[model samples]
Target chain A: MTDPARAALAITHEPEGGLVLVLRGELDLAGLPGLAPALDDVFALPRQPVVLALDDLTFLDSTGVSLLIRIANHFGTVRTRGAAEPVRRVLEVLGLAGRFGLGEG
Target chain B: MVTSAPRRLSILVGVVLLLITAALSFLAWLAHAESEENLLRRQLAQVGTLLGSQATVLQVQLADIGQVAVATDGNPSAFAAFADRQLTETGQSLSLWRVDGDDMEQVALQGVPPLLPDGGADRLTELEPDGRLVMFGILPGEPRRLAYGLMPGEDNTDFVVYGEAPLAPNGRVEPAEGSPLAGLDLGLYLGEDAAPEQLLQATAPVPIEGRTETTSVPFGNSTLTIVGASQGPLTGIQSAALPWVVLGVGGLLALGGAATFEFVSRRRAEAERLAAENDRLYRQQRGIAGTLQHALLPAVPELPGLEVAARYVAGEDELQVGGDWFDVIGRGPGSCVFVVGDISGRGLPAATTMAALRFAVRAYLAEGHTIEDVLARLRGLLDIETDHQFATVLLGDLDVPAGRLRLVSAGHFPPALLADGEVMLVDCPVGTPVGVSPSVADSAVTVPVTSAATMLAFTDGAVERRGETIDTGLDRLRTAAGGVVSRPLDGMLDDLLGALVSPGNKDDTVLLGVRWG
Candidate 1:
């Protein structure tokens, strides 16, 4: 439903013992072509305890904030936290302040 | 200091003294004039009485002259010898003229001399009709004469005695033995001049008053002419001691004005210096803010298959930088880790912590560690790196292909999930913020992933402040994010950021959202 050309998703590991995956550039209606498929791949991961660290993300609109929320709800027992300031604020504003924590080892 | 004060005070005193001196000098001049006037008046009074006494003495001498002349019956020689003897003893001028039937012959040459050499005898004969004696002579500058009338003679012959006197240079009538004006410097005019005495009185030609008495003022001519002067009394006194008062007052005012001016100038300068320093400090703070802000924020990263965006805003207050960070790292195909956290405090120190935490998160994610293991590692890293710098974070693992998300909370707020046009807060148990505890409980949450569903993650700075309940701010956040309930993940993230972050507060905010469409 969204354009894939502008959508992108990537991940890295934090030295503090967690995985930091960054969504760069835009995740919007014009970018859904690439964004939705990336979300599908993330849901396919087989890891039991994964920590997503969005420390270097540059932009996240409401669509992006909801995507993280869905992932958080999907992994209710996995324990989610955001390392970046902008990502944390969006989550907290959505009344999901308790689900996020520091990413450290 | 005391010496300088006194010196300044003395200068003030000197100025006052100078003013006083001038005032006293003027007053003294006036007093001197008044004193002189008084002295003149006293001298005039004394002179008036002295002239009266002199006129009486002359009358006594003249009476004797007439008595001798009449008793001898034209015995000019006998009268002449007697007049000479009287004149020598009294140090005055006396003349005896025998009027032998209009042939008036002067027979005595005593202290009196012939009138100037111009009509000496003729001037004596040119007397008034009732004149006892009238003549003129020069002893000082003006000639004076004494007149006498024949005392009730039984014989048909009249013999009169006349005298003239010389006035001193100072206009004093020579004082007789008993005169109050004796030895005083004053002028006395007793005889009538060319002008009639009555005319002089009516005209009030001079300043003195005329006194008239019937008592015989014995002139040497056995007659008296009333005497007075042409001036009033004078009084004055002189002293020198009053200018000091004016000088003293003037000096005090000058010193006071100078000292006050100096004090005001110094205080104004001090205030100006302080204001300048304050301005300088403000500018330096601004520079620090600009540099610190740019330093902590991440440069946008490039990824694929997902529209990802992030923005970090620094805190506005100069105290420090608010610690909010975001990170995204790729794991395997269709899998990524998203993390956001808030470090405590603001400004430089918080910025420092933010950098350390950001790198730590990157390191842990690269190591391919689990969420709980990552949090513990991050906590240990912070304890080592910052001597226990505390922070709250939320880390997530996105399984995009499977449409699932696994998240771990480290004392951070929960994330939001927008599924099927409905907004839900994905509740997860919070662990202590990293660096506070040595380790975290091994607990995590799993949320059902749906296609096109958006997940929102953030730090507490997005919803926390003084006088505000965290719950209230969270409610506002949910409401704002819920408006774009069905947006594509990236668009929804933008809408949420715009709704929640207030630009007025400069605190750092980090937000990351992902969706499976």
Candidate 2:
């Protein structure tokens, strides 16, 4: 278990014409507000393939998954890289692994 | 906790303050009394000094005249001139007397003629040799007088310098305005005792009275007794009223302190009473919520050839009951339609919404609609915007003898299937939670199981927790169900609940289980 308020994020430009957003720490209801400004920065970009880096992520809930679904519906092509086993399991059980291109539960 | 506790505390504070005020006032009064006595004593001493000073002035004047009498060898012209200066007041006299054996003669006189009778001259002859100075009271007459005689101190001096002065008007010697004894009622008397006839001078009439003090000062061959009393307080007005001031101010402070103490104490008691009342009301509302929650729940159906048991746990937090329920309807022999749904929020609104949806499910299922249709129909029952709530449900049409289950999920978790001592969480296609929009469940996922398989469907309360993943909880449930799968359905469900429900879980949990019998 982790506190979502201390959640951290980093942005990197990719040479393949996309933006990579890295997220760390527990992402929960209490931690969502801290990411708003950063999310706004991403929202300003036009139709770029967004890559999510979730290797260091420790926790995920239905609300957090709903947000990921919104991101998938927003971008041209959204891809998740190095997702942890627990995060993949929730996405798989909610039948969204195919949508986000995360293989297996 | 006693009803009178605050009142008793106030009384205690008041008594303490009153005692303190009394003690302070008493001390101030004591100081006042002591200084008053000293003041009276000091005034009486001044009166004695006044009388003695007058006597000294007379002796000094007479002694000078005696020197003149000896130097002039009893010359009348020189004596008259010097003696006239000594008679500074009206009705006064000075005389030169020659004393011989058993006789006396007035050689010279000045000012008023002597008012003494024949015995007065004889009394001067009685003055012995070496007499310093002598003063005697003359017998009572109009405007009484005192006579003084001084034989010259030198040897062989037969001439005596004598003087007489009548008392002032009414025998009252009014002290000068700024004198130390100005504000005093005073009396001076010859000799120690204050005899009426012996009164020499007085400010007050006749006898001095009212808080009087007496003292004595040396006079020629005798003493003058001085009696005095103060006309007003010796100390200033503030000091005179000091004791009353202390009492008045201290009394006010005492009452203020007591009143403040009573007010605070009563407030604390009132606050405590309100807190207890809130606690009682909270418990009462929780009790009512529990009763209402149970009354709205549907009893599990008794289907032939199937063993079923369901459990519901109310959350221990908030006064309102959570909205989570499970229902099982028997369709035919060894067949049943079971539905498990969870509302997103709580209280009467969530509970009413849950009730409406649960009833709708029962109605549609009785109409021989498929499990997918039951889930799709719920979308029309509620809208998240109007009701401020959403619901997720797991609906299943189970074939107990056939060991087959058809499941449809609306944003709900798949049920766990246990058979031959193996546990598996079914992978039903998840859809949007009901109430988000008017949508249809277009897919129904069917999974086959062993004849002895038992299935358990539950709400998210069984697995979801903050700061962790839901899969961790799902794993725990699977492990627990594998261990208890061989037991009777009711006993197995109890074991699973005890093992999987964490002590920190405050969310409501609903566990619906069905086993092939």
Candidate 3:
């Protein structure tokens, strides 16, 4: 039960000096609150494209999709990749698939 | 509500039954004790009357013998012959005595002589006129005797006859065998008063605690007191044990009844506890399902120069969450796709399937695929994932700048077009629902779009009811949509749902509407 709510967010430096924020586990209303610090950390880095990797994400909800939209708005160049089927489905349902760059695009 | 009422009534009845049993047992025990006491009193009274009469008869016989001896004028030979004849007839021992001054002289002895103390003979002379008999040597360890005096001559010469007899035939004063008082103790006293010290003959040990009765009998001139005490306030062993038996049996029955009641109550309590626990777990599972359903749906985004409104209503039954979803995807500048679909079944599986399909369509469209291409690709994706599920979907690509709409249907309800105050279902090529077949031959139809046109797409839940046909539901939707086609997109969607969905609808409904401005 706790595993779904303990979704972790990690920031790593890419070889091209871009930042990649990896979101793992469930990203629903329960786990959305923990993403604030990770967002703040990514925004503090030098202005560059930040890759939001959602490949390891097991779940996502409406609230999590809105959170991603806010993160995309904050970064000048935000590209999303590696979203699992469930997470990708939420982004597509909201018509944010093109904006988030999810699913074979 | 009906089931619980009978359970409470049965418990009330059980309590009433237990109370009634206890009351009856107490009443029965009380009646038994009362009857036993009365029986003991009656037996004691009867024994006292019988023993008193026996003592009186013995005293009378002795007094008559004294009169016979006095008639003989103190002659020893004649008195001896007469006393011997009377003693032999009565089966008692007797002696004749002459009273002189204060001494008693033995005139003749027929059998065992009566043991007299020094003043015993003088006391007998004082009883000449009153004819009272004087008893002597009747205490324990003394010979039992009865004496009475008579004055035969006018000159007042005193003659006395004394007899010695066994108080009881075999030194025991019990009632005769087979008598009702056989189980009692009888004490015979030779005086008016029936005191413990005056006890003369006793049948059995006098009980300190029991029912007793005393009767006085006239013996010659003196009264004999017969005191009878019942063995233990009851006639026999059976009678004595009756009250205790009643109480014991009654107590046992009451205990048994109480134990059964307690056992039933405990079982009922255990059943109630288990039912409450089951209800709690059910609610918990429902909560998780609700969370998963809400997480899969997101709000429709606001777009420039277009009115996009969508509504998602869960089933009336809170525990059931299904896979009905609608999406408005932005493809490029002034172009977006509106999708409405219903997945088969319910709960997390349907919800996850709906989510995957919605994303897959958006991904395909983003890569410049038409509605028909997107549906084909979604079917292949589901087939590869081994998801044995199917969905009905309607997809429409709207170009706001060019006012052109491309529509396609995949085993889904046709989208309703409201224009010029008239509502009509769009004519499009329909194919099998996605994921049911390996491939499909379906195409999208391009229709001229106008600013006055409003398009509504919804799942079957919005119009379907039990025992009703799909055509009837479609007609109702068309009529409701015509009334609200001129309103804003949000108001139009609400009015359409209000006319189509009722509180009794058990399936999830999703309505997505777009108005070209």
TM-scores for every candidate against the unseen true structure:
0.48, 0.69, 0.63
Rate residue A84 of model 3 by lDDT: 58
lDDT of 1 by residue, B297-363 (tens): 6665555555566666555643345657777787666678888887654445556777887788788
Model 2 per-residue lDDT tens digits across residues B1-517: 6448988888889889988998999998889877877888887887678668888777777777877888898899989888888888888888988887778888899877787644757888767656467876654666888777777677888888788788865569888999876998878788877888888778888688887888898887778888888787777778779989998999898889889999999898899898888988877776666676788887777779888899998866556677788888887888888888887666666687787888899899889889888877888787655665667788998986676899988778899998878999998788767755422344888898777778999987788665566777888888899899888889988898888777757678899998885
Better of 2 and 3 by DockQ: 2
Clashes of each: 239, 0, 1
Ranking by DockQ, best first?
A: 2, 1, 3
List clashing residue pairs in candidate 2.
none
Give the candidate number with the greatest DockQ. 2
Give DockQ for candidates 1 onward, in order: 0.02, 0.22, 0.01
On a 0 to 100 scale, what is the lDDT of residue B178 in model 2? 93
lDDT of 1 by residue, A10-99 (tens): 755668766545666555435545766767877676554556555445445433544554555444433444445555554444334455
- Write the residue-wise lDDT of candidate 2 on A1-105 in tens digits: 234366667777678756888878766544666777877876676776789889987866544664565566557577898888778766665555666776543
Cα misplacement distance, residue B372 of candidate 2 (Å):
1.6
Q: Write the per-residue lDDT of candidate 3 for residues A1-105, one digit (tens) a residue.
A: 224346778988688777788888777546756676776776576666779988888766434554565566556566788875556544543334555665365
